[model samples]
Target chain A: MNAFVQLDLTPLLIGVLAAIACALPGNFLLLRRQALIGDAISHVVLPGIVVAFLVTGTITTWPMMLGAGGAAIVAVVLIEAVRRLGRIEPGAAMGVVFTAMFAAGVLLLEQTDTSGVHIDVEHALYGSLESLIWLSADGWGSLLDPVALAGLPPELPRMAAAAALIALLTGVFWRPLKLSTFDEGFAATLGLPVAAISLGLVVAAAVAAVAAFDAVGSIIVIAMFICPPAAARLMTNRLERQVAWSVAFATLSAVLGYVLAGWGPLWLGGTHAVSAAGMIATVSGVILALACLLGPHRARVGAAREA
Target chain B: MDTGFWQAFLAALALQAGYNSALVAVGAGLLGAAAGAGGTFLFLRKRALVSDAVAHATLPGIGIAFILMVMLGGEGRSLPGLLLGSAVSATVGLFLVEWIARRTRLPEDAAIGAVLSVFFGFGIVLLTVIQTMSSGRQAGLESFLLGSTAGMLYADAVTIAVGGALCVGVVLLLRRPMTIVSFDPDWAAASGVSVRGVDLAIMGLVMAVTVIGLKIVGLILVVALLIIPPVTARFWTERTERVVWIAGALGGAAGYLGAALSASAPDLPTGPLIVLVSFGLFMLSLLLAPVRGVAAALWRHRRFQHDVHRRQGLLALARREAIFDRLTLKVLRREGLIRPDGVETPDGAAQAAKVLRDEKRWDVARRVYRDETIAGRYDGLTSIEAVLTRDEIAELDRRLGPPVSVGPRIAGAVP
Candidate 1:
């Protein structure tokens, strides 16, 4: 495509891939009745980063990912332990563990040496969608080997990975996940190890969250996890249908967010390109708002007419 | 630890005093506790997380307030203006959440979550715009995200404390009506409790708490203080009065501790500290409280099981005939249900027998046997049938009283 069109395509591509990555894991979370666990793990993973930085003296993605994933596991375990102790409800356990872990993470981050960290806080917030422009379709793997197409975009692999992950999850555990999500006790009665399935979903969510964190900042990561599936859930009860709608919504939002951020500048009078992550979030928000308005359940309208 | 640290610590204290920190902290804590107490009822009703949505909605109100401040040529960062703006927006948010849940097929949790995130996003957008347009006049808006009690003044405390007290006092005054509405609104309505009025009052109370609490616990932790304490306190007592008092105490303690800890350290965020401390207290209460406490319950249940096992063992080993352990065996006794001797004495035995015969076990047996009757019909008359004889029935009645009046007995029934 032309440079004009290509500029718009970058963010949208990232947004779509990010959204897909986020939404795929989110569907399982929503199904497993641990939708908020994503929110919890996102906060808890901070201490992981701090611990990683303190030990390794670096801010590489791999170390951060390991730290975050470990912390997420700790949070998951804490929630389960608290619930099994029988005093705290699952939600309360989740709320307590995540908040405590988040607070601890913040405290740790405060003490860490920031000098060696190449990425500044603002850069972290802005993200590096610009990096997506030069990478090849096969990604950085080919870059180290001096592949001829090293200069191409890397969106294809990212999108492909997200699609593959979603397919694998849906294919292997679709029936069991749906059964457990709808009724855990019944699923247990059916001899399903609901706990194992739930833990598996949480791990998948953590991996997806870490993967997408590069595309979208931590804040938007939550919006992506919650918004698309949430909006899809509003219109449908069928789990398969909800997943379909979620992917469709994510794709549309990503494409639209990319285009808007890219071109809104030429028409809208702003010099800075609209942020890809911000635009995607805004699109998700818009879609949800529209759904709320158009959805059959307007209490006021229904109440008034009924009365 | 060092002179510099001490200096920083002292400076922090000075700033706190300069802003009337003690008064505000106490006021907010008291108000937060009261509101938290009121929150307990809602928690029991399983609507604890709704407050989180209300808290999130307050952000847009702050944004609007800042805009209004700009329009009115006042400092947008002023506490009163911010508080007022948040209250209005948070109230709207609460109503919208309820409306959405009621009107749509969305579950309450989803509705709350959806509203909270969306409103928060809108708030962010507003904040981003204000920052860009006003050249950072709205810098203070970010502090509200996590809360900043560092700048709390006497007036802020007084407003929240007094308002919170009034709301809580009203809740106490209407406790009877409120409880009735919560547990059984239909029955309460029949008894002249205005369910609608009670609901309105409670919602209004929740709103007041949310507004005042925004300063101390901020948006996110506000729900924690409201929910965690009440839930934690629930483990301590079955009595509503005790639960409220304990929850209030726990919440107040959390607020106070949070303030002190934040004050002790210069860089720490007060809101997170308060929530963290509150969670600690909640966990402790959940584990160790008297009746409902998890550990306590487990202890009681274990002891109870041991006693039961011992009693059962004693009975089984009794004289091998119709004997029982003596009344003073101590371990073999349970109130009402068991005696020292495993077998009841004539009087106690009669009472126990009466209760046993009252059960419809024979009727159940008859039903079970009827289905099998066509196959053989108890050719030798099943052993259980012998227990149902007229003579045995007469003897049982003489020993005990007549069996509890159920339906008429059938002669030569299936058994």
Candidate 2:
């Protein structure tokens, strides 16, 4: 039990928090037909984090987050510019920008003297979820002790705060966001700033991705962004119910995946644990797949015809 | 760090940097060309990120292939075997992407993101599983993530080169049907071209290019070669066929140059170096291509602004309204249409009279002709002569009976 508290508690909570944070903004992105924005934002976070590491010479949290936020904004502007100037469509423009940025990030990682630090391209992909152990915890007793609580991994609190903030913001701006997403012309006619709302939504998604990235890695971040909300979307037509379902699904996958990753192998009589991050993503994908298969509204309203 | 870098770069550029490296460089060029040509269709179809999903999906296959080979009492490091495994998995991923998109209500982008991240996560799990195997310590599979050419062999290079050339050949043979489907799937379907079949074929060919590129550019950055050149080519021309070959040429050049440059420096990785070179080409095209480039667009905007200002100033002068706008006044003076004191020159008076007559002629013509051919042409920029024959303008002129002297009055001092 002590071992579980010391080693597993923070990572599991962080994973849950990260999953919920990403899924909140993801619901809006999926509806707005801007789902790839999450993918692009996650890819560019590599360069953003690497540039931060190089500049700061240490692996601090805030600088990395700031650099990543700045990079996301830059990528957004660049994609828009390329789309408008070159007359390329949005998909290809996004493809060109994010892939090039990711390549630059890889090149920078290889070129730098980062051997002494724990940060690398692989680390950036998978994150340090398993390593964020709270060694100061002494089983359930530590949960009530302030001194023991102070030794918790920073990501636990950070992810929780981000999840809460995104949830609050989503609640605050629910009406305008819902209005613009479902009926843009009507929203504009109603004197809503449609364009600003769209931009704010993307910024919110970027913030979610950057915050969740440290605990769950980028793979889970991208998956969480699309899978849970997408699954919830299949379950209900109402935006509020879909969001509620998505949060539940995200939380469920995180806890279930973390437990399976840590102990399922042992239960099967294997000695080692697999990656918690990978398992979490796989679990979310499983949930999404299940939702696709069984959800009430999985099929399109009419016979399948894409616009 | 020194002149040594230049010497090395020149040698690599000349393909004299030893046999293995020369082979790798040639292989990279061929691979890049194939990716560029093949990816044009996907880009045109607006499904470029599908390649990302396919590329990432190759990881688990690689891990599985290695474990299977080791269990079968082989060394488990064969490049062809691994490439085959990756190809198989990429095919499954491709089909899954298509299936999920069609079967579910998810937009293709959401499907793409879901498949990419999920498959990649599963692949990572398999990679961790492989690490527990005894022989996995020196598996060197990480190279498939960020490719390395440092110790690559001649045989591996030959396989990649041959595979790349074959892909390019397939692209040539499949180009027509692929083009038809990419431009308009419905039209292709109506014309009995088998839209789904052609699309699947093109995606298969892209998978082939991606598989071959795995050993050199890696899966993550391989999408760059597939996407960048076509976008860059788009800046240069509008024809789909032109885009295909032009992207091929650009991809080949970027590949060759990037491989050579990476060879010149110790710190450079081949995949990123190649991608950056391609990005460089893209940036250049974005800024410099004629008609479509940023510079051209800006110039077009400037010229349009100038024309609008010039025409509006000429109209104000024709009406004898004092031009208050600074840009309008400056344009009139700069065109030698007005004197320094804002009065119309003798030549300017004649030009302004012509302008006012055209405006008046358009006014009468719009009311006279109820047809779109006559009235729809009046955008303030289209000239009256361009819209009608001399006879039509003359008929309108006859309705007004006589021309009014609206030009500058050369101080008929009674005013």
Candidate 3:
């Protein structure tokens, strides 16, 4: 129990929060056929943080966020420019831009004299979810102690706030977002700012990605952004139910993945904890696979042609 | 940054650097050419991003291969063994992406993202598990992520070179059917081309390129080699065959240059440098390629705008109206169609009469031939002479007869 409080709780909370935060915007992305935007956003985060570190000479949260946000904007603009100017497909443009940016990020990380700072490609990919331990926790009572609470891993609160903010934004903009995702022309005819809404959705996804990536890794950010929402897509035809299903799947993946990574190896008589971030992503994929096989609405019965 | 770097770069470019650097450079060039050739079909097929999933999916296979090799009492670092394992797993990931996209309602993009992240995550999990093994500390498996050329074994280079050559050969042989299918799947199916079979063949070729490129470009940046060159080549041509060949040439150049640059300095990583070089080519193409480039498009638009303004100004001159639009007057004056004070020069008067005649001919043709095709061609700028025969224009002119004297002398009054 003490180990659970001191070690498991913070990582698990952060993982769950990150998962939910990403999955929320992911539902709309999946519906809108922009699902890989999450992938592109996450890939560019490395460069964003690396540049932020270079300029500020520190890894503070705000600087990293601002840098990452700036990178996401640049990536989006470049993708659009390439798509328009070169007459390339959205997928190809996205692939080109993100890969180049990611390559630049890796090069920068290698060239800079980053000796002591915890900034590198491996750290961005797998994350340090296992190390965000709560040292001040003694047991369950530590949850109620103000001093112990103050020592809780900063990721937990930050992820929680991010997840909460995403949920609130999703709730507030549910109708127009759904309308635009389904029939863009119809939504625009109804006086909706379809273009702005689409951009807004991409912006929201970028925020979720940048916030969640710091804790759970880009792998988890991508998996959560895709797998949970995609599984939910198979499970329902309605948008509201799909969002609810996605959130549940995200929560289940985080908890089950954290537990399996932390203790499942020992249960099988192994030596140490595996990567929590990886396990969470693996679990989410398993969930998606299962939903693909069994979800009632998995077939495109009422679906129209994709744009 | 140093003279030694320059000397080394030039030596590597000439294939006289050393046995190791030359081998690495040749392997990179061959792999880039193959990937560029094979990726043309994917870019045309609109499935270019599938390479990302296939590339990332190779990780778990690498881990499992390492463990299996260790168990078999081998050093567990054979490049062929690792490539074979990676190929197997990448095939599985490709199939999964296909299966999920087909069986479920999720789009292909979602399937790609899902498979990519999961396979990579599972692979990381396996890596962590491998760390528990006694021999895992010296695995040096991380090199695959960014690629390394410092000690590329001769056998490894030979394998990559041979594999890339084979893939490019296969791409050439299969180009006919693959191009047919990529252009129009429904038509290809109707014409007995076996669209599914051709798609599977394209995927196989792409998979071969990805596996072969794993050593030179690494997986994460491998898709860049597949995508950037093809996209860059697209700016220079409209034909698929030309695009494929140009892409191969560009990819080969980028790879060769990148390898030489990296060989020049230990600090230069091969994968990013290759991608950056490729991006540099893509940028040049985007900005300056003829006909399709940004600069060319802007130039075309400007010239088109000038023509429209001049054409309208001439028409207005025929109408004997005072030209007030600044752009119209400026365009007319520049073209020698009007004098200093908006007066029509003799050349301008003749051109305005011709313009008015074409307008009246079009107005008559619209009534004479009400076919949608001919009427639809009217963009207010196309001259009736271009659309109709001489006889047809003569008939329209006969219908209007002797041209009502609009007295264009008002604008060309020779004041």
Among the numbered candidates, top lDDT falls to 3
What TM-score would every model get versus the actual structure? 0.75, 0.96, 0.95
Question: Just chain B of model 2: what TM-score?
Answer: 0.96
- Candidate 2 lDDT over B121-237, as tens digits, reads 888887777777788878888889878888998889989999999989998898999989998899889999998789889888889998999999998889898999999999888
Flag regions of model 2 displaced more than 4 Å: A304-307, B407-415
Greater DockQ among 2 and 3 belongs to 3
Residue pairs in candidate 3 whose N, alpha carbon or C atoms collide under 3 angstroms: none
Q: What lDDT tens digits, residue by residue, belong to model 2 across residues A1-307?
A: 9998999888888999999999999999999889889989999999999899889988899989998998899999999999998988898899889988998998898899998887788877878789999989999999999999999999888888898999999999999999999999999999999999999999999999999887778888888989899899999989999999999999998999889888988998877888888888889889998998898889888843453
Q: Taking chain A by itself, what TM-score does each prediction score?
A: 0.82, 0.96, 0.97
lDDT of 2 at A106: 88
RMSD of every prediction = 8.7, 2.6, 3.0
Using Cα atoms, each model's DockQ against the true complex is 0.29, 0.81, 0.83
Candidate 3 structure quality by residue, lDDT tens digits, B166-211? 9889988998998889888999999999998999999998888888
By TM-score, is 1 or 3 better? 3
Tell me, by DockQ, which candidate is best.
Answer: 3
Between candidates 1 and 2, the one scoring higher on TM-score is 2
